[model samples]
Target: MIDDSIRPQLGIIGGLGPLASADFYFKLTRITQAFRDNEHVPAVILSVPQLPDRTEAILAGHDGPLAPLKAAVSTLNALGVACVAMPCNTAHHWYDQLAANSRAEIIHIGDAVVAETRRSLERGRVAVLATQGTLVSGFYQDRMSAAGFELCLPANTEFQACVDSAISLVKAGSIVDAAVETERALDIAQATGADAALLGCTELSVVAASLNDVNGLLVIDSNAALARACLTRLGFGTQEARGLPTVSRPPGHDWPMRGSLAVLA
Candidate 1:
């Protein structure tokens, strides 16, 4: 086990949708560089699904979710976490509101997703598949365009309805149904001549396993990206924590492994 006394603890301000929060934690644990159980991230998960609907609050310009959300952050901060992660993409519309008086640094979900998308495609149309609120707020468009990606919304209301259906199905514990809708959304995305697709909603990220690089569209998942960002910020990327070998491979040696690059050592 590694010494964690000096390491920062991670906090999650989740449950904008219960399933998405659970999936966010799953992604965070899955991608961590830990080799042992004790080496995993020390995190505080506050899953209060009762918080007011983020999408509704944003579209209506109401602050309904604000008070409870601040309380959730306060609860986590009081527990001594160094940084906070809110996996829900729609909730990020209130990101600045939440981060202003926060004791713990709030991690912005778009930064990680945009960074990953930028790395994948320097310039191209990236399908923005997310909640109506996120789209209405121009959240992904504003951030991704700065990274040189032209964020494309599926040209019709039906596309967003499909995505919304998919998100609802997942939240209702219907993964199979959600996968079907997710597939439909991808089909619409492909119609946009997109080079990549951004799974900007954490609920969509839950069924991200159902997505692949099929048809040459690079799928960027916001939940997974944010999870990775948490690991980096919390110091889990340290050489000692990852336990990478001191021996360097020969310069000409090929790294034969899966794309995820989860080191075997």
Candidate 2:
């Protein structure tokens, strides 16, 4: 039993892909430094896997998928949640509209990731691993570039397809194959000389944690960044919420986002 009065509750609009939603929830629990259950942040996760595919809707110029997302936000708002975090990066293409229609403040996961990158890496060439819709939408590229960070992406269509395959595998509950595909994308990022890589897709973030550093290039999980931002907004210090050991690196070394592969709660 958790006490809501002591802390504001968080609403999660998840199920863009069920595994990604579960991954985000697991990361939220693991990252929080809670001695007891009540010490952890209370979250209401509305996982609707049946929600229409965001990328397909965007590519096809259809607004049908946005309806369910809008409804979900409205539901969370009516539940009296202090804020809402949607883990799906591609779905953020409809962020402004969703935020406008919902009463609860919708936290921009990409914005949070950009802020974290600035804080952690200052300004550097960053690589992005995301879906075609996310890349085509330029969500991360526009925001990160506006903040003075150069962005790198899969150079060719083949690499782009590889990234998409990884995301799809994760969605289909194929973690092992998803990891292999994700690693291939990371290799491309490394070859491009990226200072750090952003796992811009929530599904990619699920497998990214299992991968080791690629030639010293830090892999930042956008989901973890969003989780940290949520905790910070809820009055927890970033360091306090992240109880992991810090690595000894050179001055201003890029810090890879921390996450794990655990059963979804």
How many residue pairs collide in each prediction?
Answer: 0, 0
Report the C-alpha lDDT of model 2 over 1-265, residue by residue, as the tens digit. Answer: 3354644479998888887888888878777766678778878999988988888888888877788999999888777788999999988999999999988788999888987787678888898988878887788988999999898874656557778898888878777667667766776666667888889999987876555456677888888889988888887544423433222334443223222212111
Q: TM-score of predicted model 1? A: 0.84
The model with the greatest TM-score is 2
10 residues in a row with least lDDT, candidate 1: 240-249
Q: What is the lDDT of residue 209 in candidate 2?
A: 58
Report the poorest 10 consecutive residues by lDDT, candidate 2. Answer: 256-265
Per-residue error for 107 in candidate 2, Å, reads 0.3
Q: Cα deviation in Å at residue 171, candidate 1?
A: 1.2
lDDT at position 221, candidate 1 = 81
Error of 2 at 127 (Å): 1.3
Clashing pairs in 1: none
How do the residues 1-265 of candidate 1 rate in per-residue lDDT, one tens digit apiece? 2245634388898787887888788777777766797888888788888888888888888989888888888887777789999998988888888898689999899998977676567798988888888888786888887887787776766678888998888888876567667666776677757778888899888777754334666888888889888888877852311221122224443223312222322
Where model 2 places Cα greater than 4 Å from the true spot, the runs are 1-8, 240-265
